[model samples]
Target: MTTENVDTLEFNPISAASRNGGYVALGTLGGKCVVLSNLSKNVVKLSPSDMKEMDLKTVCGADWCDDNYTYFHPKQEVMVFDLRRLATDIIRECQVKGVYVESYERKSGVWLMPDGGLAVNSRKLWRPDGTVLEHGIHAERIYSASGDIGFDLDTPAANDDEVQCVLNAFGGINWRNNLGAEMLLGWFGVAIASVAMRRRPHMLLTGAAGVGKSTALEMMKWLSGKLAYASTGPQTMAAFYQALAGTSRAVILDEFEADPSRRHSRDTLEIARMSYSLQEGDEGIVRGTPGGTARSYTFYSPFLAACINPAKFEPADVTRWVVLEAISRKPDAVALKEAEARVIGPRLARRFINRWANFQKNEAIVRKHIIDAGGDGRMADTVGVLLASYWTFVSALPATDSEAAKLVELLDIQDRIALHAITDEQRCLEAMMSKVLPFKFMDGIALVTRNLSIAEAIQRICDDPTGNLEITMRLAQLGMRVGCVQGTWRMFVANSPEHQELRKVFGGTKWASGGWSTVLRRLPGGTEGTQRIGAGFGAAKVTIFNMPADLLPANDGSALLAA
Candidate 1:
């Protein structure tokens, strides 16, 4: 606070015209109230306290500044020695500010300090008191007890009725289908994610159409303000990057378009990958004229996606989300969750956000314990974050409440279940079985049969599924090679003998697009570098395309040869 006022401080100009083009106020750097300026563009490294200093003069020194604060002139009009001090000062300042961090990527936004306190919003980014920069643009922000949001959300004062509403919403969510604890933890993560800038778990609430899946998401949106976009979210890669360039808020996808067998496009999958990359670096994109470059800053934030079926996303991408299920949803009562959201929601959110580091640390402990106790590696990261959020909520609960212990017990059970789910290969097996080998009893073993070609398989699936037929076909083809294959691969795309035998079925231009022998080449005998397509071919050539067949279940979820 030892800043000089503009009216009191005098600036001696070389002449009248150079009175003051402008003066930048520089503050304490490396714990000293010293100032340095040289057109350094790393503005995010500036601290919030430093950003408020008023007009200070910059002395361009060719050699060095005297201890007596004397300004010297250069012999020639060239870049000054002052450049070295400016660079050095910036490096020192960044070290003190933790900006050169390896663990935390951004120099701004919400940061969790090691002491378990939160450095939030402008405190982390060096913005003005009441503004937020999102998507490479600054936007007005209004903060409540719930912390910072991009827009205004009217939440009433904490009241008994609202508290009861929170408890009721917590109690009434259908947890019968083994989803009670995970759902509650997801709610806490959304609340905490409001002030968390790191890569956190995405929440995917799944249930039937009439269920209250969206109700919980709506409540989080109300808490999130303009920061939360409540549509199906960006389906294309460009749109997604545009919608979330610099936002650190909750982006909720209320009714995502999901297809279980669908594989994400390369660019689309990049979005999912970047969503949880949790590293420090720029995801570069070359834009502007040929000679110009602008940094399109990318970041990972919390996202919530809801739909009827949640099994569509690939195994890798699915691990990024904490899935919650609502079996019995009353559409009429959704507004009640919204109303209650306005009351105790912000208070509860503030509780976890203020101590985000504690929750994060606790999450690590829970994750290790779960994995050691035999949790799924796929579910390891997801369960850890969810359990940490749940424990944070429990700690925030009033000790006087009689039901607190019960809630704690339920949370413990939920934690155990999530951990145990990794070992429950039977469920993954059953779900996988439902796909390739639908539920059918044969003798005492379960198996599936088919003789469809690549075109026929694509037709059966794509004839009604959402995404473009071309992309769907392409993904299915990729899956046929990778998902269906076991061990190493050796087969080339297609061969002369295979095409000659399958000429009648895949002869014409329609089925002979990019990969005509996909079905015939992917059969069990595919990896031997050569495959026979049809039953006959005039002793040398045939007229049938690749054929699908019945199979036995291999323990690893791949199809086994039963021929």
Candidate 2:
């Protein structure tokens, strides 16, 4: 009942006071029943009701330190200190020698390995416990299976025939390099890049059902072990936020296709769009409850998917994946069997990991080289790691490796691909915008105006010619929101929820939108605003873009799909 009997009580008064350099006693000092003091800190005397609000009994340090936060476990368990938020004391009592309170807190949602690194599974991370899981989902760290062997190319050296056989099943060495690079990313993607460079490209194996798409993914599954997952993968943005609360390397969304039966596939496509830029600072907010656990979850993970036609994938999402179409369209039964039999799965996986790790070791040098060779600045690390992965498998003999020499060549191809894609997209956008700018809208219904009197939106470019690309780039920057207001598309820059302008434009509007940055798009009949439209000219799905207006389909303007 009194501070004098603190030793007899479970709470250690001396330790608590020492931690914050303050005295917390149940004796009146300011005409109050309790006195709490810290060195030149806030002095608040809590009455009985106020004590409950402060959760006083749980206070270990000062009156209110880290009282509200619940830390994560490496295995995705949500937990808190035994004495409310007094993590230090509980960790001290845990008697797990050498483990700090922060270590157990899993603040990073990643395992800070005792070996001095991090472990992530299923894009999920946790506090390190000297072990990591060997399988994805529900499979926590495989005890004693130190990431020592699993994430490295520790396999016995295979002969050319053995390696070539595996290569053949994966569409030969050409496909192998690209696929192998992407597959290894499934394990280390989230960990290797900084926030700016953290986008981990996904993988798509497209082929007829029996063409062995599953077999290719199975090969990846073998290499990845616990990091390869086959679940639906954060089915909704809310679920995506929840998923971010954990760790993972790669996720598999199999048989990926837009559900033809549905009116729209917003959930599916939004999830796909998200896969491209699921890093810490991306725009999507999780949990409807603002400023809650959603604040703690940041999304980043690689995806490996198989589908007949990734009909639902957007061009933006398409670029985020390394597409590998099955060469044997009629179902390569032989190749399927070979891939599943672990012919080169184990060795190839090892080599990829080891080489990728080596690239990371030489990250500075490799990154410089890629940039010098004109690799896309945004994906420099990606190209460097991919080239390193290719060279590692091409030959152990560095001198004989044309693969290493091809780093420049590969990067050249990448630059060309990027340039070509951008050029094509710009042409398409110009055509669409040409049609769009002259259109007249009343009550949000869009119709082409007979006269070209309304200033062409192209004037936006003439004002700041550079601004056109800036606007275009911003549109494609991972999570830009182009909402459909009635049948008209508006770049929903919900210019800050605090702005009266935003409230005026978006207030009570039932718009189906993604991220607070977007205005929620409201469809007729109270439907959410996601739709599936086929993208042509090799685009896996339709995308918002910038280009020459002359190239846009004469009849198509801004709709969810071009078709």
Q: Compared with the true structure, what per-residue lDDT tens digits does model 2 show for residues 1-563? A: 11233221122233432234322332332223332233322223443344441344433333334333334565767654343333333233322222111101122223324353445322222222323343221221221112332332224434556555555555522342344433333323332221223345555667665656676666556544544445542255455555543343456667666565653345545554565566443444344333132223444556667777565544454455566666553344235353443444445444433343343444445445656655555444444544444444555533223444455554455543563254223332322233321322222343333323112433332333333443333333222233334543333232234534323333333221212332122111222333322112121222232322332223344222421
Best-fitting candidate, scored by TM-score: 1
Best by lDDT: 1
Q: Candidate 1, residues 1-563: lDDT per residue as tens digits?
A: 01123322122112222222221223333333322222221123343344321312233222122221233557765533343444444344334333121222223344443344444443223221223433111221211112344322122233445444554564456644454534454455543453353445666677777667766666667655545556653365656667765555456666564553443333444554565644334543424434342334464556676777554454455566666667775443424455546545665554555445556665666656656555555455665566556655555432222332333344454554543444222232222223331111122253334444443433332223332333233322322211223432222233343343223333332343324433343344533343332222223221122222222122322222211
Sliding window of 10 residues with minimal summed lDDT for model 1: 135-144
**Angstrom error at residue 342, model 1:** 3.2
Give the runs in model 1 whose Cα sits over 4 Å from its true position: 1-108, 113-117, 123-167, 175-177, 181-199, 232-236, 259-270, 282-291, 309-311, 330-340, 396-563
